[model samples]
Target: TSSPTLTFNDGNTIPQLGYGVWQVEDDVAEKVVRQAFEAGFRHIDTAKIYGNEAGVGRAIASSGLSAEDIFITTKLWNADQGYESTLEAFEASMDRLGLETLDLYLIHWQQPKQEKYVDTWKALIELKKRGRVKSIGVSNFTKEGLQHIIDETGVVPAINQVELHPFFNQSELREFNASKGILTQAWSPLGQGGELLESATIAEIAAKHDATPAQVVIAWHLAIGNVVIPKSVTESRIRENFAALDVTLDATDVEAINGLDRGAEGRIGPDPAVSD
Candidate 1:
């Protein structure tokens, strides 16, 4: 039941396995989150755009777990990508989450077209100094986008969350993050659904370990030093997702899974660095 952990640039450690709430309904998000907590997940990832922060807050408050025992992460949306507006948006997110401070806060998108992400990064840096957020990072940022923020602020983000899975390993961006000491957090780490889970290659590996295909893939992510947050509303699935930490994939198995990467990405989500 021991989950892996990684130390961030800010000297804080985050559990490698996290429960992500991307499209879960607010009403269901709380119950599902509670299930995840009870299942031994210490990290929870949410976003302002998810519209479930209040529900997530309720679950965290009622979990009977001390706040210090959890690593909670939330993100700011695109429209809030500026200094003052980002500050206000951060406040709104904190209020919704019912937390005085966050373990980590991230920019949900790069939105370079808006040309305000640098200003947003500056605001996040100030937020860190103000002690409102422990660490700051970005999501959907390309290497160039991350470098832009670093060049302007002179502060490297603690993480960069992006779309990652066995199908799209993101080698170059991952190398870039590793070189900069930024953690690469994977959203949709399982792909859109159970498609990859049903693959014969994954199934064979799962059989060898007496584990599920999903768990096999998650172990692959962990072996590669990537952070993974797999979302699910089903209580059983939540429990199963947490069990991924227990399944260790061998190098040969990892290589077999790594072979699945297309080099070209099968990204189900938009590239927010360029999207509207």
Candidate 2:
């Protein structure tokens, strides 16, 4: 049951396989986070917008696992996209999570229209300097936005999390992140809208490996060097997702799955550029 980890630019490491609480209820988040821990998941991703960080904090308190043993990630919402506001939001998030230090803190979205992410990035940089957060990154940022932050702050993000799945491989964005030494992380690793779940190609490969379709997709992300976090409130599904760490996909299988890309239209989430 060994789960691989990826090292961030900050010299800290993150579990490649983790659990996320996107839409899960607060009460259910507590129990389900415990289920994920019991199932061997050492990483947990949450955000201020999730409205369940307190429940997640409870799960951590009851899990009997040391804070150092868990990799927790949370994001700063778009409304909190300025220097002081980001710091305030981070404080609020930390209070909710009940943790002294954060493993990873990210800008949930660029909000380019608001034109405040640069200030947000600087606040994160300061947080890292103060030994508050281990790593800082952005989510749903385009290449131009990423470059702007790096140029303005001269500090590259340790990771860039975006909507990724077989149906929208994000090949170019991943390549760009690689060039900049930023790890690309997959949120919604299973294609949203359930479109990729029923693919015959995926089913065939899953059958060959005697793994579930979800596990096959997760392995594909791992094999490609993308950190993946799949969310599920159901205990069985949480355990099922953790099992993806054990499955290894061959080049042939990975290439076949890569063929599922649906280009720009496949995006189930909003485009970050205009999201503001």
Candidate 3:
């Protein structure tokens, strides 16, 4: 199967299965990003806190592909969560990425305790109006948090990036986003390489399809209409991650995967309200 696509509320399209460079080191990010591009991945997700924006920029600049051919996303860190500070942070990130405009820029997290995310969202709207950012969204935001931003700003985010995998499915939150026009994007879609591989259901499905467990899990995500960013510094795993598009899941496969939803009670990352 070919790679799938998800059209955002803004009408722009992003590849459903993309490459993520969350913890990749500066020394390796550029090269790995290039490799992911060569592997046929058109979307690349990174963050300012990941400490590899400069490297990601180098890879994009040298990829021999036009900037418009790639869908690049980066985030503004929590420390930079005020109106002016958010503007400054966005400019700095663009400078590091060597891009005049970004495909997507998201608030890295909703640090509610500080109560500055609303201001930050306002700044993002300004950035969008200034033509410095093409699309804006949030990461690590709950349903309540998402509603708070929209209720305050009257702007529906184009996407919501969260930690989701077979073992910790976020069905209710995704339903809420769908109702509000925000596309659900999965960050740790494979449980950071742990639970996904250990899933009995995944292994059985892999056997039935003659595919790897990772591929089955990723295909399952695609079948359910999610944009997944699976990260890997290894060449083989990168190739394997891309191959997930070829494994088509049947109704049984879909049901088996859907049964994994953990309801309103799963978390892979710290709750932002108390984390800071």
Candidate 4:
């Protein structure tokens, strides 16, 4: 009953179902992350912008799990999107996380307007070459941005984490990522636990499968093959979301959820193309 995993193009595998700590306070992140571990999540997604990497590191230290037992992913913030700056930021992040080697490191945003992601990606490629990080990838990158990096360096990203949910599935982007062997990771898989969770369709599907609306939505994400990271500060909710690994949806159910896509209107986060 553990979380499933997906392999990156580089041959590294990531847990498909991970616990995310986006808005959790730094002081509280350690407690909730510990709760997530106890609930059986082995992968944790965090970012420098999230401001909880130190607490996350504390939980990892206290969990009694070896470094290889967990998959830890952290991202480089937008402001640090240059060659030397990215390297410095990685060192600072490592100092905060208390880790010698990182599981994955990502360019948190393309920040295309800044016109530095190409060089930023080179730094990540260099990190991978030096074995500082096991895998390197990007987040909030559009297809154009992804192509630009790949064309510039001849290296494809291993993953692309973005805001994805039933409401804003990003089917076209997902297809493009798949075409290039980049695994798509969902940042807001539950749509911030608002209207999407309250949808009549999700409620009906949840009742049909004897699952919570959150689990149903998560299962839908799994069915469509996106790595999902759902965050919750409450212990009970954390455990409940992890149990989504057990929720199985039929083809009909998957089709019904797929029908919920709201196209561009459903996006809840900043558009990567214009974010910075």
Candidate 5:
């Protein structure tokens, strides 16, 4: 079976499962991203802060897929969060990606302390209006942060990319996204390596499906309806993570995994409200 997709409020659809390039070095990002295409990933997530958009652009150029066939998403860095600066930064990112239009563009972080995200959000709206981006969203935004933009612009973000996993599910934020018609895109979907995979419960579930722990974790994310993006440079793991599309879990299994939520203690990434 192929990967499934979720619809955005804007009438665009995104592949539910995607590959991320958070820490993947630029020197090797093209190779790794090309490997993801071979592994059946159509959606790719990157950021200006990741310092790998050029490599990502290179991989896309050689993917043998048309622009419409792939979903390319990149983020706006915190340093360029003002209205005019955000527009300028968008141009730079577009130049690096070599794309006339981006599938999705996100504010990498709220950077609420800068007191500029509200203006930055306005820039994203302008980009969407001019058709530079098919969809625009935010990453690491709190419930209040998301509402602030919606209230200011009357244009809801298509998705909220956040750190979510079996451990830190961001239930409250996810619920709010659901209610507000915003998709929840998961980053660090595997809990950033073998740490969350070490859980005996996850291991047991993996055994039940005859799959790897990473696959089980990803399946759990899809089962709960979050658009998941797990980053890995290993070719085997890239292929393995995509295989979550075929894995299915039962209510009993979902309940067991949901039991792993440790609330605030399970968080593995920086708090969105405090993070850059």
Candidate 6:
């Protein structure tokens, strides 16, 4: 079955469940991405820092699928946050991805201390105007960072991808994004598969639904309306994670998962507020 989609503020729809290639090495990205495609994933999230766009491009080329059938998203590195630099970096990314027009492009981080996100956002705006990218957004942006760019350019981001999971639900951020018509996309949706996956609570819920803990967590993300991209290099795990689209969590299940939020302590990534 096909995964569901969420409409961005710009009217573009992204598959609610996407395949992420964060830690996957460039040499193996093509293989695993192709396997993800075979497992029914239509959206792929990559970044220049990941060093795998070329491999992803190769997979897309060899997948026997049309460009329109896939939603490709990549980001601008922190070092390239100036307007001119962002523009040049984008063209370089396009060359690596081998795409004439990209589906979505994002400023990877707010880099608030540098105070360049506003200008970087303008470059994305210019890309959209030129039809080089269909939609533009940001990742790891705080509410203040988001507002800064919006206040400057009067352009709200279509999406904000961040570290979100049952352990660190990011409810406040999610609420803020919703209030601004922005879609919240989850990065570490499964809590990186350690203790969070082994929790007795998730295990119980998984057993109740006859699904894996990862799937249950993913289902929880969907139940609450966040776009989720779970990553795995193993073929079976890739297929299993994609099958999460079929796992339906009821109100009780979702509430139990919601209670697992660990607030700031559960965040597994760099704090965007202080990140360079």
- Candidate-wise lDDT, in order: 0.91, 0.93, 0.89, 0.94, 0.92, 0.95
Taking all chains together, each candidate's TM-score versus the true structure is 0.98, 0.99, 0.96, 0.99, 0.98, 0.99
- What residue runs in model 2 are displaced by over 4 Å at the alpha carbon? none
Pitting candidate 1 against candidate 6, the one with the higher TM-score is: 6
lDDT of 4: 0.94
Q: How far does residue 123 in candidate 2 sit from its true spot (Å)? A: 0.3
Instruction: Give residue 112's lDDT in candidate 2 (0 to 100).
Output: 89
Indicate the residue-level lDDT of 111 in model 4.
Answer: 96
- Tens-place lDDT digits, model 4, residues 60-98: 999999998899999999989899999999999988888
Model 3's C-alpha root-mean-square deviation from the true structure amounts to: 1.4
lDDT of 6 by residue, 1-276 (tens): 888999999999999999999988887999999999999999999999999999999999999999889999999999999999999999999999999999999999999899999999999999999999999999999999999889999999999999999989999999999999999999989899889999999999999989999999999999999989999999999999999988999999999999999999999999999998
Please write out the lDDT profile of model 5 over residues 1-276, one tens digit for every residue: 567989999999999999999888887999999999999999999999999999999999988899988999999998888999999999999999989999999999888788899999999999999999999999999999999999998999999999888888788889999999999998988989867889999999999999989988998999999999998889998999999888999998888998888889989878888875
Name the regions of candidate 3 deviating beyond 4 angstroms: 263-266
Cα lDDT tens digits, model 2, 158-273, are 99999999988999999999999999999999975397888999999999999999999999999999999998877888888899888989999999999999989778899887
Tell me model 3's lDDT, rounded to 2 decimals: 0.89
User: What clash pairs does model 6 have?
Assistant: none
Per-residue lDDT of candidate 1, residues 1-276 (tens digit): 857789998898999999999898888889999999999998999999999999999999999988789999999998888899999999999998999899999998888788988999999999999999999999999999999989998999999999999888898899999999999999899986757888888999999999998899899999999999998888888898889888999999999998888765666788765786
Error of 4 at 178 (Å): 0.2
Per-residue lDDT for 13 in model 1?
Answer: 90
Clashes of each: 0, 0, 0, 0, 0, 0
Tens-digit lDDT track of model 3 for 3-64:
67889888888889899998899879999999998888889999999999999999999999
Among all windows of 10 consecutive residues in model 1, the one with the lowest summed lDDT is 264-273
